[model samples]
Target chain A: MAEWVEACAAEDIDEEDVVRFDHAGRTYAIYRSPDDEFFVTDGLCTHEKVHLADGLVMDDIIECPKHNGRFNYKTGEAKGAPVCVNLKTYPARVEDGRVMVELD
Target chain B: MNETLPGMVIIGAGECGARAAFALREEGYAGPVTLIGAERHLPYERPPLSKDALAAEAPGIRTIAEADRFEAADIRLMLSCEVAAIDRAARAVRLGDGTALPYSRLLLATGARPRRLPPAEGSKHCLYLRTHDDAGEIARRLRPDARILIIGGGFIGLELAAAARLRGSAVTVLETQSRLLARAVPANIAEIVQAEHERQGVRVLLNAGILELGERGGAAVFRIDQPGNDAGSGPTEIEADTVIVGIGAVPNVELAEAAGLAVDNGICVDACLRTADRAIFAAGDCCSFPLEIYGGRRVRLEAWRNAQEQGALAARNMLETDEAHASVPWFWSDQYGLTLQIAGLPDEGAAVVRRDLGEGAFILFHLAADGRLVAASGIGPGNAVARDIRLAEMLIARRAAPAADKLAAAETKLKSLLAA
Candidate 1:
């Protein structure tokens, strides 16, 4: 079963910005890459409990604010040191100026 | 001709050695790689030894690569092996077990060991946090209501103190210096860190002299003297069931030095991490290389980032590609729910501009007289300065002298400055 939830207005997220999307008490970090692509990932860093939405998004990578460890925005793969586990990615798309993510 | 291929041999299978091997494979070097380490456990990260591992958190132990990954990568990992001597003439290293491994290029990643306290012997319950076994022993002693005494006020000691306090252990830190992290951080930063520990119910004693360690009723007792008061004239006592000594580390340069390689405070290597002998190279905490970003001052960093970056860089350099270890030094410490990330070396006489982001969050930029950002440190619970502090590293790299006002202004977007 696919449940698509409208996270936020796509226009609300600026280039290279990340926003926390909360629905039914579950949180996800939706990011707008520098390339203007939208992607959604598990909100918190696996290394620590810090939220990835509060991290720094540069180009296609999101640097965890807690440790400066980075993750690939599109695939949610841990790309740098201090972070070993991969971030779970969700199916995300922009429809009619709104960012929608598919969750199970 | 020797039947074995003349491949790369890396000594000391810590983060640096292990990562160098993996980087070599990733960089398309398919030669026979041999990774040797003194410790019996597979190469694991040392940073967590004082953090999550100490706390007995979800992630029990961490390895840079999985055990099977070595086999998949065709990298031979030799555990519990000690390299006794390096025969530069023969282009081989002799292990303690009397096996000589030949290599075309060698990397000395034999990191560092904990510096033992003076008169280190005779303490029944003293411990040093360095290896997996050490962490396990320390964790076992950190039972609830256990009294733990830490000997130094450095990063490792403080981290252990935080973990102990988390486990309901009574923590007490004794610092011979007047402040915490005296050598590493500035006075203001130390004050904040000390305050955080104190607030967490950890008794911190600064400017206290440790006279001796003795045991009474199955407990370790520390004799101390307090400076600047009558207490200095008399020896006082603090007792604990367990004592952890987090006094710094000493570089394992004996093998390199014995091999007649250039050795100073650490193994001396060039910008390419190549030692005096072109066949040999060194990186990570064990080697001192020129830090061009900081005016070519030779520095050996013990941070996890430095080890991984330098290790990979050294591998590339060994593959005959010239790569300089010029990345700005960066490190972070998580304590009492606070993450302090610092980038670059704050030079002496550098002007510091600070911005308070309310609710105990702030960012500081250290700039030269010409206003070139030299370093930046951010402390906050909510990712306050991590993003912006990286900008400072870039500015430092480019030698960009942005105005101090631009750096201090909360409204200023650091990324925008990158374009300019």
Candidate 2:
């Protein structure tokens, strides 16, 4: 695994906005919830692998606009029909006054 | 019938009917309520008929009884009386016998029946499954070594094949389409399922046609017409000791139609599951209402969850409050040790998203043109999709927006929950 990269500064997105960042040639959806919470997970719905970056993000939950399936952004757990898998989550941290994730 | 809304009366003691009764009580209606059932059993769960009852999947998958149970819930259960007619003018329902029950509100939860195969000249040994009693009979007559020929690769047919294989029977599934489960899943997605079932020793015949289902030497032999090549495109034949037909279902609509209610492929209903006649409400398989998912398209769903949830929602709206029917359609099927689940409703023109697949587990999501959730199917991942669908449905109620991040966390936890 590669060393963790400071992919994006914490201020890069709105609280409810989900932005895509790349590290180690992999894509991730870095979510900054409306409550100023920071979370990172594989940027896709686990069930159909639809990129979560393109899904509907609510409070702490994101719904795959594709099938309206949902997942908890914090734990990356998928909720809804046509989905029963979990989003791969990367441990998220707020360090150096910025959102930092150990993405290898 | 003229003055005040008649007391609510629900026909059929299935899960929908029972839930309607409970929901009415929950709705705080002080008027008289009655439940008429054709089956003698209390509103027992019917999903087991296709799964546990046939494969012995669970020790006691009996019908659920809440704390109020039947007695405590004050549900007037009328067992073994099939409603034969609905006198809409008089605001009364006529039973098979000479009894007529007058009601101010009537819920037609008269479910569906299996579609029979085309008739042949001679007698053919065929079987179909729907009710608990149907499952019981099939279970009793199931022979471990019997070879089974099943028509229709739909959920019910595939489920029965899975059960039959589990019970030590040789199973062969035939589908007229190029892929199995064509109606439920995208073609490419269905390929994965077909492959899985095949890996488990199921004989899957696709792009094959059946001239007829007839009896030959006491066995059901399906005459096949293959489509790919000259050699395979001729009239071929397959034989089995037992034949199971699952070509889909026809909604039981005689009573609803005869009652002068709006009837299409199923009983027509508005946002509140109300038929043309305001006095009647229909739920479960017998009715089709405007579904928000298919872009306000009217569709009929026969899955057990759709039956139960919609039935309850309709009940709650009809008796208790003036709430609209907002039940999101959901369904699950177990086949070849794989559990498939769905959330939302799907039609012909949706896009398919292939999520994940490992060791015969994965998911297929159906998305609409604008990417609004239309339908999804979880294989080995059904539980998550099922739950997310439910949660999304609630969000739809609030007409609120969803945070993509929260859904990701929920998705992460779902895998563990499903395994547990």
Candidate 3:
């Protein structure tokens, strides 16, 4: 079953940036797209388990800080070499100035 | 002569050669691809050998891709195989097993081997790390009661020291130069690294000259002279259970040289990573190619990212895509809780502007005489400076001339400057 959980304030993360959130002993990354839309995915890089929050976000893509592994955060698709495993994405929305992610 | 069709042949199976093999398939070259490796294991990542591989409870090889991935890609892997000579006239490489493999195009990614200390050769107490098996041997000696002595204060030596300290081993580092990472990083960054190592209970001796190295009572013993010591005091002797030599690496260019390819500090290649023979090319630590972004200055980088990028580039050029290598030079090292990242060549800078990111985290932006951004170096705990350093790399690639005031101000977004 999926449950909606409050992650952070909608304004906490800058536009075109990502922030890390921990809940129920699981790590997650919340992204605010350049258009102000919210998205969420597993926090660690699939390649090296590196924190995705430290990575740079350009549009919908996130580049790993350690090895430059790239992934499309919006669709959970790995972009290229050094990273073949795709990230797991979650349903995200903003309500009452709070970002909510559906976590199972 | 071999009966098999000669599609694409790669001479080495390290990160560079392995990546090139796959990259060829990705570029829609639906032809036969063969990757030959001297090692028995599959192609693995080397960066972890000095850090994570040493610190792990049960260290194992971190391969670039699994064996099944290779099978699915239809890439032929020839492991534990050595190419005896490159028969250029016949366009075939003769293997040590007396087999000849021909190729339409060839890539030499033989990489490099550790420079062995003359005195420590064949000594069981002295070890050098260049492969997975080497890391396993070093890990066995990193117990709590063990004493570790590291020679050379370069990235490999410093990282090993950090790993040893984490495992509760007593570690000491010796550097012939006045500072650590003298050739790779600036003095300011080197000081931070040295301090971090000291904080972790690692002894660092700079300007320490090695007098002799020998085994006594099954322990590695070293006699060293400290620069500030009295003349009559003589040399000080240090003993350790294990002595690791991380002096440096020499490119494996003998094969290329013997095949009549130009060899400078490394195998000489053009901007497109191709040798004088259009059918043959070289990449990774084995090849020294001109940097187009730096006005055709030739440099040989032994970095992970460089190897991957160059491998893919070589694959493209091998298929006659004719793409010049234009990426800026980038490197990173992690020790204790601090991470140091450098983008572009710092030596090219005529001046520097410092940017503070709070909590002892900062970045130094290097500018040329004409105020063009040349490099950016940052050191901080975790990934405090990763984003900015990445942005700085882009600016340097664009040859941007952002104002120093804007660069020094932490409030100014480096991404915004990219749009400008």
Candidate 4:
């Protein structure tokens, strides 16, 4: 059985912005798109493997911060130089107001 | 674009080859594109082989293209096939399996191999990290307590030293020059790296040249000599469980030259990357073309970015875009988490200016003649102030156009320098 972990307070994230949360020995980046939709991906840059939590989030894309490689926040597909690996995206759900992640 | 006449057959499906292919497609040429590789893996960045591959836990490896998606773009990838010979006269190529494929054009992206030691090589302790396999094997051998001796202190030698020390290895960098990265970078910049390496407890011995390579007690030994010191100084020997040679690379121009192309330090290609024959082109580590910054001298560049960019441009030219590939050469190496970026070319006597020389320390070397920004190098990329910085040296035969005009003039020179 997997756990429905409380990741972060939904109100903590500003619109079209991102916030990172730690839970159950795991770290996840929570983002709110310009359209108010929410998504999360593995918090790491595909190039140089830097943590994506520290990367730049721009225009529905998470720039790896290092080498400037990017990935779609929605699909996790890699875009740009230096990184070719598609980012591993994590699915998320929102409660009445708090953001939650299902961890297996 | 009518599949542009004389389709190109590029060998060695790596950064150079893939760039050429993508450039061709992006230029709207529905031509026949054949990308051949001796390795089965899709074209992956190779610079990391000596650095990141050794530190898999650390990241920054980005593949310039989609791995599986290359085929979707109709790139004829002949992977895992050895290129036997290039039949230039017939305008075709032969694989190791004896398959003759004709082409109206050819690109010898047949990248170079690591310059190895003697065939009957003595010790198994010696190493080189030019390929992924080489890096993987070296990575496994890297131990904190291991005594690692790097034969050359060029970028690879110094980079490996940094990585090995990070893993707690007793690292010693042996460079024949009095300063590190002497030929590649200016003496002062080399001194900075040397000081930093020494600060990190890396034993950097400059002007201490290696006489020969041999083994004693399962360890590699480098017979040492310091020039102009004395004759009876006797050869001092240093032993290491592991030794990596970075003496430099020998261009893989045999095939291109044997095919009747003008060969220099690399395959002699023009500004258009066209070889002696218009139908053939060359780029990357195996080719050397004229560099305006180096006083129109032809020199070889083995930088990662140059390989990829040149590959793309070669492909574009092989198609219909007849644009000259004159991008200012830029290269960077990452080690100890410090990003070292160099733009343009610097030769002996080129003036240097230290920008922010602290944690954000980046010194820009301005190689100017009659006050024009002939070459600009720093921890970052080029600066449009090249003409000003370069022009400052004008009185000493280094002055040129005014610095103010280089940028504020609202001219295209700024745009072109920025592109490089």
Q: Which CAPRI level is candidate 3?
A: high
The regions of model 1 sitting more than 4 angstroms off are A46-50, A77-86, A95-97, B1-3, B57-59, B229-235
lDDT of 4 at B134: 73
- Can you give the DockQ of every candidate in the order shown? 0.57, 0.03, 0.87, 0.07
Alpha-carbon runs more than 4 Å astray in model 2:
A1-104, B1-6, B56-61, B66-68, B120-124, B233-235, B348-354, B357-360, B381-420
DockQ of 2: 0.03
lDDT (Cα, tens digit) per residue for candidate 1, span B229-290? 45455348998999999999989999999999988889999999999999899999899999
The parts of candidate 4 lying over 4 Å away from their true place are A1-104, B1-7, B56-67, B116-122, B227-235, B292-295, B357-360, B379-420
lDDT (tens digit, per residue) of candidate 2 on B351-399: 6655454454555545556554445566653333434444444443333
Listed per candidate, the RMSD to the true structure in angstroms reads 2.3, 10.0, 1.6, 8.1
* TM-score on alpha carbons, each prediction: 0.94, 0.72, 0.98, 0.74
- Better by lDDT, candidate 4 or 1: 1
lDDT of 3 by residue, B1-420 (tens): 233888899999999999999999999998889999999999999999999999965688899999999998889999999999998898999999999999999999999999988878887899999999999999989999999999999999999999999999999998888899999888998999999999999999888898888778989889888875466354388899999999999999999999999999899999999999999999999999998878999999999999999999999999989899999999999898999999999999999999999989999999999999999999999989999999999999999999999999999999999999
Task: Please identify which of the two predictions, 3 or 4, would achieve the higher lDDT against the true structure.
Answer: 3
Task: Rank candidates, TM-score, best first.
Answer: 3, 1, 4, 2
TM-score between candidate 4 and the true structure: 0.74
Superior candidate under TM-score, 1 versus 3: 3
Ranking of candidates on lDDT, top first: 3, 1, 2, 4
Instruction: Return whichever of 2 and 3 wins on lDDT.
Output: 3
Model 4, B170-280: lDDT tens digits are 988887776788767767667767777888888877778667777888788777878744564634778888988787888888777767778878999887788878888
| CAPRI band for model 4 | incorrect
